[model samples]
Target: MQQRTFEDFKFNKQILNAIEEAGYTIPTPIQQKAIPPILAGQDVMGIAQTGTGKTAAFVLPLLMNLKYAQGEDARALILSPTRELAMQIEENIRQFAKYTDLRAVVLYGGLGPKTQIAELEKGVDIIVASPGRFLDLYLAGNIVTKSLKVLVMDEADKMMDMGFISKLHRILEVVPRKRQNLLFSATMSELVHKISGDFLAFPTIVEVSEQATPAQTVTQTLYYVPNLKTKINLLQHLLKDDETLLRLIIFCKTKTVADNVFSFLERKYGAENIRVIHANKGQNTRINSINAFKEGTIRILVATDVAARGLDVSNVSHVINFDVPIVIEDYVHRIGRTGRASQTGDAITFCNPAEEYYIRKIEKLIRQQIPVLDIPGEVFIEKTGFEERQAIAREIDAQKRKDNPDFSGAFHEKKMANQRTNKPQHGGKRYIGKQKPVRKKR
Candidate 1:
């Protein structure tokens, strides 16, 4: 609990003013530990979870470095896993550099590349980017990376998880290896370690919090739902409760499931009351949905894991994990959406039998047992486990396919080929032979 005022950091007056304007009175732990090393032009590996002010940790020092080299070409490049996070980092930089003449631009996919290209042509001081679109523009000679002085890998763990290793490698090869490197992540996995090994030279390590640790303010609970349908009912019941009815973000595992949950909630509640956001939705739609949620115009926002990254909304009363995330770290981040800025909040995870493994992983990461609550009533209890239903559906589908003698010759041929070799399935769902329908279609 080391409390340091912004003035102590010796940030430029412009940046200090911007920080004051942004309402960040005190420096977060990561920021205090990281900014000095970064200012000294040292490679840094910062490990901190969401809501820990990791962005400012690098941004403040990077801005300080850029202030002297203002007229030079793009001196900094910050890579984020999602467009939203890229935009977020860039926004922070913009606010911090308002009085300074340093320019900043965000380059990402899902929007027109023309504006991004034009910005690159104009030569920005900082560029916050997602890996894919940035490389596309860079390789096309639309953006220059040869003079890159600082490279910040924001959410480095997620980049590796998203299979951006190759892209990162390619970008690294092109940029000046002698430049300052900063890597930040909520959790440090083996993959993240490997990636860091490649990108960072001898680096200053900063670990403000334990790996995958949830914020202390977040109150986590597990609701036992027997099936998916009942989980929905439980969610409705929970939301209707007076205390839980405030601004909420419901995390779904996939885009389809998010859409389905959104539609169901809208129909059950009111269309105007809830909004669905995911990668499948347009950029404007996602931004609008998030803004609406922040403004309280939309009480509920159902979103996939990717789209929910870097969301800065405050006062989110509850975060419902409608679907337990495949990746355990995601559970930490999802719940982190609430319980931010020292405010107490609730995170209710709806767990089905099949998803128990995911929940266990989450609990292991957070190093605590999530208190479980059984859904009230026999009907609700029986209908709670959505993961089990999904597993059953897959099993039924496999059985139907196996039993279908006339399903397809090619399918059987491929299946038999795999079976003959006795190759183990990668994901480890048992191969129950498909079932054929007895009724014939005329």
Candidate 2:
């Protein structure tokens, strides 16, 4: 059989013209194999990770099918795990449908319901939404699912990790039973397999690669920092010396840790040089931060595991794992963000004694030994627990305080004096009566 180009697929002129305008001359392997079956109206099980062009693979076929039959309600529904990813998918649809009149709207949280409701009222042919926000609007009678022709669960594994299986079931109950179902995931866990069994009907299963495999283009290395202070020092040194790094993403395990790392780096380096984004940030702020990072306006982006799911920043020079992820597969996704679209990149992880167990599990999952770099003049030992970690954090905080002299003491004194000055005179009543009596005596 001869290989087919994107033009070989019989699509509407509008979609083909848009594809050409977007400069996608050739289809990816996954797209070539899956688009035909999808257009033929079959349930698809697509297993691929971020930066794999999975969005276009599904979006193009969906556009072709929906363009044939215009509907007032959303003909296709894409459910992603994160707001960022859902928005990205919606943007992709817009770009692919630029010449066409197919309307698409994004449904996400961290924004007012009125805007989303207004968009839905205006009527959208395709709706891309996160699971949580989708349910909220669906329950409120803001969206109609009875007209849904194609139901897609993008990033199903991430949804399972976020405990959205119940929500998925609820959505499934509401969406029509005889609709095309497509489930896409980076990897297939037991939960994803269960979803497959329940939702799909002997579907054309497509596994592009092994579930836990990281991209071959990524050169992964590990460095044992031994302590939090040493980790900071090493990161600073790495950033200073590496001129090849155009943009860097440093991943922390929690929001507090992410903030701490961002603050530490901001103080060490200039605050203008770094951007921090996580689930805690507002939607617009997060989007702006990510856009800045993408456009090379920001050099470093410190994020939590929330970014590990669906962020598709390209040409990322380095992916630094400040803290090893507890879920082993996340390591794969975190590093996978760097080496994208066949571009060679690097993934560096800082593992301390406390995180050695997690590191070992990650290595086992990826089935490769991440070359460990021993920190010079450092000793490794068993972890001393959270108490020791907090002591270290306090020590680092103290060092920061010492290095940058705190003028807060002076400010504190001034604030106290201002408070004293603003206090009422020491009298039960105003002193105006005493002043008048004194003037009269004078």
Candidate 3:
């Protein structure tokens, strides 16, 4: 069978030239399925995993719809969960609309909106923005949603996870009632379904992959490290083979872990070769780090989940989960950083005893078990420290209790024993005083 190409999309000459210049000849599954519906002015609900060219699926059709720049107010609005994703969509628009005069302005927080407002005043055909910033500007009269012909929510599942439903509603209320709506998400949760019902009218449902599943291009592996130190040590061992682990991303669950991993790697690999990014870092700093990693100037990038979405660096060789993600859905997004654009890559996860709980849930969510490998003999497995051990124990107990309602953990038993010892000598209360004692709330 002959493979379908971009030429079949019937895009205008400007867009075709731009697509050719971008070196994209073949349409991804999502693009092939979702583009026609969107171009036909129908509501579209696209459910595809990350790194499946979802951006182009929506962006290309929107570019075709907009045609060229005309109005002083924006005609299309694309809302993303994070500034990184919004900027990424903006770049995609620029790439596909290079030969045309269509204007796209990206609006995000973590910085003053003066520049963004200035751009909006100059007239834009498309606006890519984070939900909070989008609402803020719209409420402040900088954004004119009356002229909006299309509304798109990229990473719709993420937006719901980040508690953007109310803001989404607000944005929806302000936009024209008859505009085309397009919703895309890697996974469709109940919240996403509810929003889709509210957003789309007779929508074309397009799902290219299984929900919460990574691409086939990625090979996954697991290591049962004892604790943080051993995970770091295993990372060191992995990085020793620089040829295989050329460009790597280390995803930690928190900013602290990301900083710790970055500092350790910087000590050994030097700051010039490693960069870290998280919410604590300034916006400019995070953007610079992402750019550096994408340019291959840095061999390793340590990041939190903030970098998990819309990081379109194509040549990432490997992704190491320094810590298992508490949000199981993020596991899909984290590993997705690699194996993008149909390139083969590796995803290695380091799971300690406590984190093993979350890893189990992640396995169930993804419907697959990661193949575990024994720790290498050359890599020293340090003894778990007392504090870390206690913390792990507490976490495991909590997880067990969460699963079983009747589960009385050791702490519960100890508390019951302590209360028994402190109880009245007799079953009856205040026998000596022959009076009822007032009881306090526990």
Give TM per candidate.
0.86, 0.84, 0.93
Residue-wise C-alpha lDDT for candidate 2, range 329-383, written one tens digit per residue: 7888899889887788999999876577677778787788999876644333434
Candidate 1: lDDT of 38?
94
Task: Give the 10-residue window scoring lowest on summed lDDT in candidate 3.
Answer: 424-433
The candidate maximizing TM-score is 3
Candidate 2 steric clashes: 0
Q: Which scores higher on lDDT, 2 or 3?
A: 3
The TM-score between candidate 2 and the true structure equals: 0.84
Best by lDDT: 3
* Candidate 3 per-residue C-alpha lDDT over 321-409 given as tens digits, one digit per residue, 9 for 90 to 100: 99999989999999999999989999999999999999999999899999999999999999999999999999998998999978798
Model 3 CA deviation exceeding 4 Å by range: 1-3, 413-442
Model 1 quality (TM-score): 0.86
Instruction: Give me the overall lDDT of model 2.
Output: 0.83
Q: Candidate 1 regions off by >4 Å?
A: 1-3, 377-379, 382-390, 393-442
- Residue 304's lDDT within candidate 1 is 90
Candidate lDDT scores, in order, read 0.83, 0.83, 0.91
Q: Which pairs clash in model 2?
A: none
Q: In model 3, what is the error at residue 222, expressed in angstroms?
A: 0.4
